[model samples]
Target: MPNHTLVNNIDHKDTKIITERSAAYGDDIWFTQTFPAEYRSVQAYYPIFFTKDENTGRFFSVALFGFQQNENLFIKDNRWSVPYIPLTHARTPFLIGEQALMEDGIEKHQRVLFLDEDHPRVNTEQGEPLFLEFGANAPYLESMADMMEVLHHGIEDHNAFIDMLVELELLESFTLDVELNDRSQHQMLGFYTINEDKLAALSSEVIAKLHQNGHLQPIYMTLASQSNVTRLIQLKNAQLGL
Candidate 1:
């Protein structure tokens, strides 16, 4: 379980975070949540798919890195092999939390930064420092704050986009079957993808609405990203040396 606590410079001035990408630091995830704003970059290197949360049953988008669980093929030589990492993956050890603040004598909740003390990347020595010598945020911390801000808005957009997709009945469940060069086979299930037939069958007015609302491109981007599945198979074959 993650031990999350509010971050303050005074109490955590000496905190450092390991920025390296490696399985040792828990980068061995097969997929991570993504949003439409990131689809352009994510589609270039990953296959974007929709999945439902087991607990909430809410649908969300993800960038697939591998065919199975805990099999991240993008980690190479203790580093991310790709140029762009999904913001959800890049913003580690830090997450957005709510803080109550007084505004005109009324208490209001505001988004604040929270740190996961139990994360493997967190430490007091080595790696990127979170605070400078004089209780100010370091460059790495600043960047993380910016990332969290982007993620906050991205999640909002993601929710609205998913609602639109669900309303239009554009999502469909899918199962992916993979065969490795060593003759080993695997099946990936419980994921969803866009229903192209439904999308095409949508009325022109509906299509125009999607385009006007800035979702049509991402829908197409998700479709385009499926091609990267072939690349993933190649990587798996290379990893298996067959």
Candidate 2:
């Protein structure tokens, strides 16, 4: 469970967040949520795939880091090897929360910053400080807030993009079977990818609409990212000494 609390300078002036990438800090994730705006940078380093939420049955995009659970191939020597870290992963130990406030006799909802008090990265003695001596947000905290803002809107865009893809019947289920150099086999299931056949068959008018909506490029980027699976397999083989 997460001990979530609203961040206030008075109560958390000495709080610090460890920004290092390491499994000890809970960075050993196999995949993380991503959005179309990040597809260009993400496609270069990881394979982009769509995954469905079990309870809601809604699809969302993810960038795969490894073949199995808790196996993040990007973490080496306590560092994330990729140049571009997904926003969801970059904003760690911090989350955006909505607070209802009354402004001029009107009730309004505002996004507020919340931190996980029990997270390993949270401490009072080390890493980036959350607040300065005068009780103002530190530079690191500002950056995290900005990241959270982007993530908040990006998720909305991601959902809309997925809905468009679904309406167009452009997503297809896929299963990947991999045989490592040492003959070790791994199978990936319950993932979806862009259906190139369906996309190619779409009318030019539909393609124009996708282009106008700024989603066409990301669609191609997702397809191009499939090549990274081979790179991922090589990384896995290297790990196995195969």
Flag clash pairs in model 2.
none
lDDT of 2 by residue, 1-242 (tens): 99999999988989998888898999999999899988999999999999999999999999999999999988888888879999888888999999999999999999999999999999998899989999988999899899899999998888889989999999999998989999888899999999999999999999999999988999999999999999899889888887
Report every candidate's CA lDDT. 0.94, 0.93
> How do the residues 1-242 of candidate 1 rate in per-residue lDDT, one tens digit apiece?
99998888987899999999999998999999999999999999999999989999999999999988899999999899989999998998899988899999999998899999999999998899989999989999899999999999999999999999999999999899988888999899999999999999999999999999999999999999999999999999999887
Please give the TM-score that candidate 2 achieves against the real structure.
Answer: 0.97
Q: Estimate candidate 1's alpha-carbon lDDT, on a 0 to 1 scale.
A: 0.94
Which window of ten consecutive residues has the lowest lDDT sum in model 1?
Answer: 5-14
**TM-score on alpha carbons, each prediction:** 0.97, 0.97
- Runs in model 1 deviating more than 4 A are none
